[model samples]
Target: MTANKGLVATAGTELDRLAELYGGALTYEAAVAGGIPIIRTINEGLAPDRIRRVSGILNGTSNYILTAIDQEGLSFDAALKEAQAKGFAEANPIKDVIGIDAAYKLIILTKLIFHRTLSLAQLAPTGIDHLSPRLFAAAKEWGLKIKLLASTWESRGQLNYQVAPVALNPSHPLYQVDGVTNAVVIDSDLVGTSTYLGPGAGGKATANSVLADLASLSRGEQLTGSSACLRIENGRPLTKQRYLVVNPTGLPTGLQFSDRHATSALTPALTPTDLQRLRATNPGLETLALGE
Candidate 1:
């Protein structure tokens, strides 16, 4: 099971059952971040500690596009084209830019860390295609960088996930990660916080991860599986955060702008539900969550 296909980790895949019946190790080291052994690390190294959160820039293509747009002042389409030219992105990079790629990786992490499985439809990730040059300019002025972040955490004892482009301040660990690099920030009760950084793409890097898994099997080490009871709830978490709204044609009725301008504003703390409602009502509105 060296393949990185996301379907293997989805709900009802019965991956654990198949592995058990076959007496084989279920290794998916390259399934998440290309070169980051995140699955193994969480399964073994940090098993004792309770993981509080798993967050990262999991998709290299999306990260590269965002970095190019921010650093070189390239438009979204131009940055994506450049990424394709550099082999950082595919000719059809819809999954990467649309956040579905990261969502798949997040699904795997959620299962490994929290013993939970979620479908792609349940994740419903938000993409980076809507971002404009003005958003990048505003982020730079605010001393922040925008990254397509995939994050999952337990909020009030329930798991909450978000895969979207977020404006992160300088202090964040994943803030400086750029180009085709991947970074995973794991925060646990014992370790407090640990960041793993590496090349996210390229055949060599991905192959190395696959080889590592094969080597583990040769050493008679088998990947573990959990039989924990599954739990699920719909919709994005209700946790509130400030948002950067750009070039809004119409604002949601109750949504207040802290910046005092209609063209652009840093919105007051709002929840995902609020944003969804706003989007449903307001067309041509662009927004990015302000990372804490």
Candidate 2:
């Protein structure tokens, strides 16, 4: 409900206070990212046994910054200042920059998805502050873009949650989201994968989403499906196939690979670790996967 310096702490305390006063008939949702309305759907209707992964883009400020940097060639500082000037960022901007804003939203989302309460401390938070213009340039060269993504996945009783910038290949649906828009992709056992995309941080857009939810409630309908609460046994960890560009100068000695396709493409046998090492050493190397 509130996102001051200690946004997560404030949210936790407020939820507890309201739970006591309202006998757990409490719901909390906020327009933190662009105009996205992330509702805290915690109540008896929740079923802990049915959820698998909760993931989404939870910050409109970062999204806008990245979009501007990629599309308009704006420097990070310039983009951020532009966002602040346009009322997209707060004067302080630490919450959005440090990912505390997204972390708070994830905390609420995870609680609702898992049908259990989790403190903000349980989730690890990362941010896009470390991203440099070099990375953006590299992304452009690699035919990709960078975006800050926040997600939580549970498998075999282990939960992984992080907020960080990621390089999305041209094929990933997320790569297409430009400007201040936001999207959430939820994968579950019953329904497989479902994606919701729209504006993440506008007053009017947020009010529209809230009104839609209210209309559904008035009709005695649920925004989530009946299988929303279903649970599944944690399975294998999800792995993504990624692409990497490397400078031939920094490549380790004796790594044998020929220029099969335009000097940039390598054989598919290269491992992710190898690519990571190459990325670390190569100053201007870029990489991008073909598609999602």
Candidate 3:
């Protein structure tokens, strides 16, 4: 019965233990994605399946800012101001902009689904303030959209996660999730893939989620702690991944690229080592991971 993700996520599952000890249920459906019922979906609907990955546009303020930059060609400051005017952002908006808001949500989900604890220090989230209209424009040249994506996945028996700005191709499920709207794509074994999309904020939206939790309480359901164990790993790509490199100075020497733009280029599938070497070879180059 908490909407404070910062407290719940950072508290290291103690709240869950206390609730179970007191024979009470702790429901936090509103803490993650507003009105999405994602927690219930995972705890009930998708409980039987094995989830491989969970990714989403979790922050309404950041999404609104990025969407404004992409659709209206607005500068970052201008877009953020517009979001505040539209009530999509807070007056300060520091947590939302710096990816801490989304990181908290991701940490909560990781605890519930993967039974792992992740600290913000371990997450090392990347904010969207570094992104510019030029990055969005470059992505558009390849039918892509830039989004502040929060993702968690299992790889080689280890849990890897990250929250950052990603270049999503059109075919991706989250590509069309724009503005203050939120969307979560869950990849599981039995059901394949399931997507949940809706308005991520507002009194009515969050109230609906709160009401759902109340209903579950009325049904006499008690909250329980995760009884499983999982290995947590830092944000690292185990497999090859494509990247969109934006360098106003042009491509780096000895780098092979295709779909070249004036200030950016699409890189082939590269390993983490290759990306590290490329960054060493060329300083100050913005590299965005291309999402599937």
Q: Pick the candidate with the highest lDDT.
A: 3
Candidate 3: tens digits of C-alpha lDDT, residues 182-249: 89999988999999999888899999999988999999985433324568876877899999988778
lDDT of each: 0.80, 0.60, 0.87
Whole-structure CA lDDT of model 1: 0.80
Ten consecutive residues with minimal summed lDDT in candidate 2? Answer: 227-236
lDDT tens per residue, model 1, 136-166? 8778767779999998887666787878889
**Against the hidden reference, what TM-scores do the models get?**
0.88, 0.71, 0.96
User: Which run of 10 residues does model 3 get worst, by summed lDDT?
Assistant: 221-230
Residue 80 CA displacement from its true place in model 1, Å: 1.2
